[model samples]
Target: MNQKQEIQEGLWDEEAAQTYDSNEGVFAPEVLRLTVDRLAALAGPGKALEFAIGTGRIGIPLAQRGVPVSGIEFSRPMVARLREKVDEARIPVVVGDMSEATAGEEGSYALVYLVFNTISNLLTQAEQVACFRNAARHLKPGGRFVIELWVPELRQLAPGLQAVAYQTTDEYFGIDRFDVVSQHVTSYHFHFGAGKEARLFRSPHRYIWPAELDLMAQLAGLELESRHSDWDGGEFTADSSSHVTVYRLPE
Candidate 1:
């Protein structure tokens, strides 16, 4: 894993951070809302931790639902934005590498969550495994660790299909280019009008299968409790677009 590339690609800078939330609403808000609803059912009143809690997209709403939430984020600008939505005194936001973040004053939580394919930000197998281990360390006995990510198989492109484009808005556009041989995915974003600019970001993710994730959890002393295809609890199948995996530490 190229640690430098991972950090540079995943962590948006101050100028880009300013418009991230607005551009993110194209898909993030609705997807995260669904995640919150699902977590609310499982978390109840228990304390929760959000890994890579970018701009409080999921953490803020979860807190609003009455869950005490803390977060670990690598990007300073993103955490800064999160603080604007919720007070730091109320929601503790720790700025550090997610894979190495220890349970500090917030203590262990009943639920530790990583969403929106954020696991891909780790970029290396060792880092990803370390993230699992760290998550286990931050969980109370029998606590749950939840992850929401797009099934990697979705990136498979047909012959002659080099780029996939999604229109986010009249001015803003999202373009994803596939590099199957290199096992790399690059997303080029274009913003028009006042916030007009073009930015290129690349993330290298090992698209592990569901069974592989289960194995990783087992290796970390966590048990795979549930695997759903979507946030709504649909059955996971070959054709599922997303995987919502839940793992639990032994009591």
Candidate 2:
């Protein structure tokens, strides 16, 4: 793949797409329930658009809740996996980059959401800002844009260390190598099986602080509405590991 394609799809190829949901840790029923619940409530009675809606993990359930959901995804294989669950007629998806792609009619959606730390996948500040603008372009005047991202745990790293272990188990391991100067992170995940070889997958990302993200929202004509530690609206605090933030376009 070329540089552009690499940036767009990253490591989400056919094999990754096929096995994406196999990680039951992320696909747990209770976890998705919270996500879909919050998204459905934010969507209200209007249409919703999801950026990088891989495998329709949330989109399928949101649509099942009677919300009209659309998506923008760059990986054809991921979309193909999504199609296995729901037809295109139910959840229309535009195959393109979330940073600049136009999905549905401009300003037609009541909600545009990017979840699961997917914004970091953009790999650049400019692309991340453009993603905000793209989400704004798809929203109605009062529409909301929501993002679920992990707070960088640089505090966990000892001085002079560039890597942090995010997960460690007998069956799997995950770590992030951070470049503080460039605000970039490369996540490496290793899956192990008994009597089988270990598998590795790594992807690059550009991490953004909440304050920086708010500035990007401002640049896109969106204002910070609410930020919580989770979908249940827990208070965000210094010790929080992840956040779900909401931004709104003025009416």
Candidate 3:
């Protein structure tokens, strides 16, 4: 299989899926609330879709707010967790890969969202651009597509300096070794516990600037509506830690 498929399959592996939420708490309720609020304000109680809605981190809460919500997820274990959450709260979800999800069933959504740097999972330009097309197809005219991703500038290291990076709270550590010759960064993560183990997840993402993302949206027949540096609607600037970008479907 190709690298992208391997990455995708590995993510859905039962063991990995079970521990995924704990590994990534950046999308906890507080962060998700901010995302839902912004989209709700813009879309005004219309239908919504959450791509890669792993464990319903964002989808369940949005559904509780009385918005009709549907989600597409690839991992069966992740979807099982989402199903449990949905059963507890009466939400609906679909099991499928976000990149290939057709625009049927629920018809179109006023707002469709993907968060927490999940877009990078594609690991290729073709897949990423196809994601944009799929999102557009699933959106109604004048709808909005929102995405939350890291700025990618945070990985920059100073000359002649090296440091260790932590992925989780005392759970995983990585040695971030830089290769100046190749202009690439590689991190080797060690999972700490009884019988220490190591796993390597690496990718070369072309950290596109906000302007560049806007251009991508334009190419997909979407327009930028707003851009923020954080979940709290802070103005985007060079020093921003993350980006919350909102794009609109043509009327």
Candidate 4:
């Protein structure tokens, strides 16, 4: 990847922070348990580092399971939300961009993970590659780097269609505006409630193909160790909407 492209950062304000935990699609117990269980198994007795560990979603639970977990997160509001559940002593976090931040000893973690499509928040291919390298830098030799991400569904976009309403429910409505040529999307989420005001959140992302992510890992000196369609190690096939992929540094 070219190293000179100007990177775009995300804005995680109070609204974004406050509503993060309300996403039942992700924050539901069963949803979180699978992720925590799988990560804990990979973590063994060693430490795990999280990139963009928003509100300690996975970090806190993983740490509680006896795997030391630290994190790098850029949003103050998000960090504040995390503090509500656990103090810094429980799941320590570094406040900076995950692509450029350090949270623990170099090459000291048994696993480094970025989940919930957080890698897409980097907004540029170069920064995404840097994030992979950062994960590698934080990993012990032969340690794992794992990520959860949605596969790009550009095929759903009809000609001249720049936007798609990917989700609509009684409580939530979500849409994504596509920049197909640029591999970027700006997602808009409108949330509803029972007799309460509607809430809106907007986030930008740069999508990457699985092959492109593999190349990034290769550049970071990490090799693809495994990939599954979900947290439970389901087979990855053409129809899967998302994937959990793990890579490893040379032992």
Candidate 5:
């Protein structure tokens, strides 16, 4: 495998891939439903290309919603799990890096979506910019490119602090350590089960600010259309934790 193929190796191993559908924190049905509704409406009768499709949590449902959906995913194990949900005919998946890969012809999809903060997986500003350009390349004129991302929440950080624990439960605890200079955050998830020792998983992400993402989109020939706090189109405010923003190619 090339270096790009190994990008998701340690994090997206078979064990983690298997747990995806069962993880309610990540795969809540209502979340997927709302996402599909919004993307389907934007897609209309045209096709969509999902970045990092990842077990089809969104792509499968979007395809089931009657919009043709294809995906570019880097993890083979995750794509294998997605294959169990839908066949290639229903949702064709290209196994490659979303930042640099294409599902088919360029300018073929009407909507290109990267949900669940997946763009952060790129791990660098340059990669994120390339991803935006790649998304724009796959869109037809006037097609939409949508992204869901968490706003950087650094207000909780005290001076000289580099890490914060944001989630705690009886069986789970989550923390993120930020590298201010690099704009990167490494998330650590700890899981405990009855009568079992704890397991920890570390996922590295490069978080981008909303304004930075807008500039990246602009560099890719896309114009910002709207920004919302959620799939329901609520207004985005300074206090909002996450956002769903849409950009469009010129007609």
Candidate 6:
């Protein structure tokens, strides 16, 4: 297997795909309502394509709202899980790396979206830039590309600290170890279940700031349209922890 395939398997194999759907907090109706509403509005009358469309989490609901949606995914296991929810005719998915893969013919989509910090999964600057270029290639002249990413929380760390605990609870613990010089971060998740059952998952990423993300988009012939703190159009501020940014290709 190639490097990309290895990464996909390491992070999203069959077991991970099965466990992914068990997160009730992430799949709640209230949480999905706003996200689907915003994406549907952005899709307008044309089709939308989702990069890394894991288990059809967002794509399925967005399609249910009357927008034509397709996806590009690297993990066959994850795609199989998605297939269990919807058929190929309703929501076709091509198995490939999003960084350089083509989901369909060029200029066929009105919107392209990457969510939940998936861009950082590329783990390299070149790959992330290529993913932006790939999105531009698949979009119509007036199409929009959207991304929802968390702002790096290095500021929360003390002067000499390299790690930050983002979540701590009775059943779960989450921490991120940061390498400031390299912009590399590894998130460590520890889950504890009943009867002494425990599990750990680690995912590495290359975190990008908003300014640098805009530069990548510019390199791909896309212009920044708007940025917000969330899907509800909250203003993006210095204190915001995450952002929803939209970029547009010239008409």
Q: Look at candidate 1 and tell me the lDDT of residue 86.
A: 82
Clashes of 4: 0
Misplaced by over 4 Å in model 2 are 7-10
User: Per-residue alpha-carbon lDDT of model 1 for 1-251, expressed as tens digits?
Assistant: 46564565455667646766875452476777788898987776788998988788788888999999889987788878877888887788888778887646433688999987888766666778888888988888878999987765444566778677744877767766766665455566666666545555444455555776788788889999999988878999888878999999999
lDDT tens readout by residue for model 2, 1-251 = 67968755658899989998887966899989999999999999999999999999899989999999999999999999999999989999999999999988999999999999999998889999999999999999999999999999999999999999998999889999999999999999998987888999988889999999999999999999999999888999999999999999999
Clashing residue pairs in candidate 2 are: none
- Candidates sorted by TM-score, descending order? 6, 2, 5, 4, 1, 3
Name model 3 segments beyond 4 Å from true: 1-3, 27-29, 103-107, 159-191, 194-206
RMSD of each: 3.4, 1.1, 3.6, 3.1, 1.3, 0.9
| Least well predicted 10-residue stretch by lDDT in candidate 4 | 1-10
Native-to-model Cα distance after best TM-score fit, residue 130 in candidate 2, in Å: 0.2
Which pairs clash (backbone N, Cα, C closer than 3 Å) in model 4? none
Deviation in Å, model 4, residue 245 alpha carbon: 0.3
Q: Give each model a TM-score.
A: 0.83, 0.97, 0.81, 0.93, 0.97, 0.98
Candidate 5 local lDDT, residue 164: 90
Lowest-scoring 10 consecutive residues by lDDT in candidate 5?
Answer: 1-10
If both were scored by TM-score, which would come out higher, candidate 5 or candidate 6?
A: 6
TM-score of 5: 0.97
Candidate 6, residues 205-240: lDDT per residue as tens digits?
Answer: 999999999999999999999999998999999999
Arrange candidates by lDDT, descending: 6, 2, 5, 4, 1, 3
